[model samples]
Target: MSLNVLITGGAGYVGSHVVKTLEKSGYFTVVYDNLSTGRADWIPDAELVVGDIGDQAALSRVFKRYSFDAVIHLAARVSAPESIKKPLRYYADNLCGSIALLKQSRKHQIPCFIHASSAAVYGNPGVAPVGENAPLLPINPYGASKMMAERAIMDISGSSDMRWTILRYFNVAGADVKTCVGQRPENPVHLIPKACRAAGLGQDISIFGDDYDTIDGSCVRDYIHVKDLAHIHLLALEYLAGKNPSIVLNCGLGRGSSVKEVLNTAQRVSGKNFTVNRKPRRPGDAPVLVADNALLKKTLNWTPRYQNVSEIIETSWICHQRLTGRRSKN
Candidate 1:
């Protein structure tokens, strides 16, 4: 029997990708989202329930309606700068909302829980390729909210039978293979999509702080393709279903790509010229963050397909043109 997986925030960027990936793997998928940032057109065929994760009454109603075997929690306010400006709102939504979801999970007795965590949890690790044991020093409110929710999960799991896996994602990029879905945010901040759009459409791409301590004086990050990251979730679900112990893993390429490198790759992939504007560093921006993916590899025996930054950019540009009708002739 296929497991019925309840994916929160299934209409959003990464969640939507997971939805498509899950369907491809033959899982019975159900989406629960409030449509705050998620689009209605994202989850086309999946059963989508328009509700907030923080609403216990609404959650109970949904839980009563479906017999979910597991859950993939991806719903949260995910903006770092916005979180800094709206700390209380972020806490209420990300932190409090997760607690509410856990209450419902305990009520439903869901066996497995997969959390979509972010690499921002390690605010500023002293070294690159930080391991899972790295200190959780979140400099921004968004990361703090995630760290706090993780603590809550740990405390709750000590008493409950919920087996959970926390995946701390690095910079997620790219789209589905057929371009069925991709990042469709109105205020896009992710580098790959932004740069790809600019490169193909001749728009201005802002380079944040070209004075960072990196190869090109810009910040370095581990860019993981969305499809590869989606497969990691599937692997985590299988691991949990096999009655394995709950684990925390990082989803990344185990390498680094500077901002300039990414922009150059985007240009090279699309064969277009776009203006690059240097801007001041945003608050709480980490100089470098790459994942030590050895544990993920050894634990799940996972192999990433799109590990190259150029491949990520290429796929993203194709999807961007398909979605926006900005096909470039180069």
Candidate 2:
């Protein structure tokens, strides 16, 4: 019998890619999205259900209708600045919704659970390459919500029959190389996609805080290709299916790229000389955050294929141009 996977927030940027990957890998996939930030058109071939994770009635119905062997929970309100402005909203969506989903999953006896966590969980650590064992000092409500959800899963794992893997992502970028899906947030705040859009329109892009302590005096982050991240999810699912131990993995290449560096690469890839305006740093902004993905490689035997910076930028630029109908300068 084939495995059935239920992906919350499956119509969103990263989740959509995971759905497409699962479909290609011959798994029966079902996507549950509220269309709040996700596009309905993204999940065409898979079983798509429009619903909220917080809605117990909706979740219960979906669980009852399908025999999901595993659950990949991605539904959440993921905006650091916005989460600061509306903390209650973040808690409700990120924390409460996850609890509700886990409750429903337990009720249905689903064995595997995979969560999409963020690097914001390690807020402004003095350390360079953060590891899984690093201190989790989240500075914002968005991070707080994800941390809370991770704790909930850990606690549930001790007693419940559910096994889980939590992947803490750092600066997920790039698009599906196959062009099957791409990032389409309602109001995208991610650097690469937003920069691509600005370059496409010949608009001035803002570089938030160029005075941070780094090689270029700008905030540095590790950007991981979305396709690579999706592949990690598939590996985690297979690992869990084999009754492997519950684990937490930091997903990223163990390298740092500054904001100015990203902007330069975007301009080069898009062939557009877009202007950049330096601005004050937003609240809860970290000076630098890079991952130490040694554990992920050692444990899972996983190697990231898209390791080149230019390749990531080019793939993202192509997808942005395709969506916006504005080709980048050659």
Candidate 3:
């Protein structure tokens, strides 16, 4: 029998791609999302439970209904800038909701948990290629919330039979290679997609800051393709199945790309030029964050298929055209 998995926030950008990967691997998936950011159309193939992650009563009902072998918790308010303005909201939703989920998982006796974490937990690590053991010094509320949630998982798992894999994602970009699913326009805050949409519409894109201590005086990030990250999730599930010890791993390309580099690539891929504006730095913004993905690669025996920044931007450009009904210039 196929393992039944419960994926919270499985309809959002990363969550939807993870659902597709899991379902394609022959696992039965039930996506539980609040639809605040996730759309119903994203996960058309799997079951969906529309509810807030903070709603323990609702989550418990679903947990009682299904014998889930594992739970992939991806549902969280994910905006770093927004989290700075609303710190309590981030803690309540990301931290408290995770606690609730852990409670329900223990109650239901779920064997495994796959958490979608972020490199933001290592805010401004002052070092490139940050490893899993780096001190979690989150500079923003979003990162702090994720860090606390990971701690909650670790503490709970130490006392229970729950096994987990925490994948601390760097910058996740690109879409499915087949163009089946990608980041939607709803609250487009990421750099690549924002640049693609601006280029498509002939609108100007703004760089948050241009005075960081990076190569281009702009922020640098390790942009991993969403498909590659999705594959890591699959590998994470398999690792848990093989009775590997619960582990934390960094997910990225082990390299860095500047913000201006992303904008340039998006323009080149879309075959359109848009104005670029430099704005003051936003709070909680990191100067540079590159992941030391050696653990993830060695642990899961994984390799990324899309290694080029141009290829990653090209896929996002295609997704932008499809979502906006614009013709691709190339």
Candidate 4:
């Protein structure tokens, strides 16, 4: 029998990709989003409910209406800087909202729950290739909120009947190779998307910090293609189907790329020399955050396809061009 999947925030960048992948895999998919950062047009085929996760009444209605076998919780406040400025709002939206979602899922008796966690949970780790057991010293409120929610989910996992998978993703980049869906947030902050937009608009881009102890004197991050991350989620669901306990996995390529390297790749791919200015590093900015994907690969036998820097930049650049209708140099 096919599974009935409810994807919260399914109209957003990563969630929308997961929705499409699940639909293509023949799952009956339903999208629940408030359209705060998500677009209605992105989720084309799925049944979308424009609602907030914090609203328990609306959540009850949706769960009661659909017999969901699994729930992929992707809706959360994801800005690091904004989270610092509005810590209470981040906790309310990311932590409180997730608590509400978990309670509702328990009431609905969903079998499997997948959460979208972040690599920021490990703030400025002194070691490379950080793992699930790495010390979770989140540097900012956004990461703290996610860690809190993850703890809540784990606590409920034993009492509730639902199994869960907490995937701590690194810098998610690239786009759907088919270009069916791409990163199109109303106010973009991610490095790749922001750079793409700047290149498209012929505007100068800025690197937050340049004195970091990386190879290029800039902060380093592990970039995972969105499609690859979606595939990991599917694999995680399948893994949890036979297990009783909740699982935690880091979703990344286990490789690091410096900020300057990414910008250079974008310039090379687009053949446009967009001006870049180095600025003071923002507060809570980590020098390096790379994932130790050994568990992800060993546990699920998953391998990333779009692990190349050029491929990541090219796909992102193409998607940006398609949306803005501007020709990048190349």
lDDT of 4 by residue, 15-79 (tens): 88888888888888999999988887787899999999899999999999999889999999888
Across residues 216-249, which tens digit of lDDT does each residue of candidate 1 receive?
8999999999889988988899899999999999
User: Can you write out model 2's per-residue Cα lDDT over 56-108, one digit (the tens) per residue?
Assistant: 99999999999999999988877898988999999999999999999998888
Q: Pick the candidate with the highest TM-score.
A: 3
RMSD of each: 2.2, 2.3, 2.2, 2.3
Q: Which pairs of residues clash in candidate 1, taking residues 3 or more apart in a chain or in different chains?
A: none
Judge candidate 3 at residue 295 and give its lDDT.
Answer: 92
lDDT of 3 at 194: 89
The C-alpha lDDT values of all candidates are 0.88, 0.88, 0.90, 0.87
Clashes of 2: 0
Error of 1 at 66 (Å): 1.3
Off by over 4 Å in 3: 326-330
Q: Which stretches of candidate 2 lie above 4 Å from their native place?
A: 185-187, 326-330
By summed lDDT, the worst window of 10 consecutive residues in model 1 runs over 321-330
TM-score attained by model 3: 0.96
TM-score of 2: 0.96
